[model samples]
Target: MEYTFDQAAALLNMGRNTLIRRLREEGMLGTDNLPTSRWRGRGVFRVITKMYRHPVAGYIHYGRTVITVKGLNAVSRKLRLAQHQPEGSRNRASWVN
Candidate 1:
């Protein structure tokens, strides 16, 4: 089942912000917390976009990212691996090559 970041963080025994920060540092997520193309996939995440009606704007699209069970596990494993690695190296953006 898909889980929101809050639920995933709880399951991973981490704070939501911390999880997001870690993902940012790993170049998996952008500053807005959306997954980068490299990590945005069926096994990792599902993005839901909702169109909200506005008084003057007519409609605006808002979205949220949910983690799959696989994604949660993936994140847990990545974080564990990261703990053993040195810092500064992983903070660079992982662009699509």
Candidate 2:
């Protein structure tokens, strides 16, 4: 099953924005707050877009990023590893698991 960002964050014991920022920093997410192509191909995340008709603006689209089970596991593991990094060791894209 997929989870909304807020739900995923809660499951991961983090705040919503923190998760998004971390994912973006890790190159798993784009500036649009959706999964990047690499991560998407890995079955990590999905963006669901809904369209609504506005009285004056016609169709309006809204996108929401959801985390798959695989994504939750990947992100949770990454966050745990990040917290246990060696002193002076920095977070890097290569270390993302």
Error of 2 at 46 (Å): 1.6
Model 1: lDDT of residue 67: 81
Candidate 1: residue 6 Cα off by (Å): 0.7
Q: Compared with the true structure, what per-residue lDDT tens digits does model 1 show for residues 36-95?
A: 989976567788888989999999987788887567657777787322122344564431
Q: For each candidate, what TM-score against the reference?
A: 0.76, 0.73
lDDT of each: 0.73, 0.75
Give per-model CA RMSD.
Answer: 10.1, 8.8
**Runs with alpha carbons beyond 4 Å of true place in candidate 1:** 81-97
**Which residue pairs clash within candidate 2?**
none
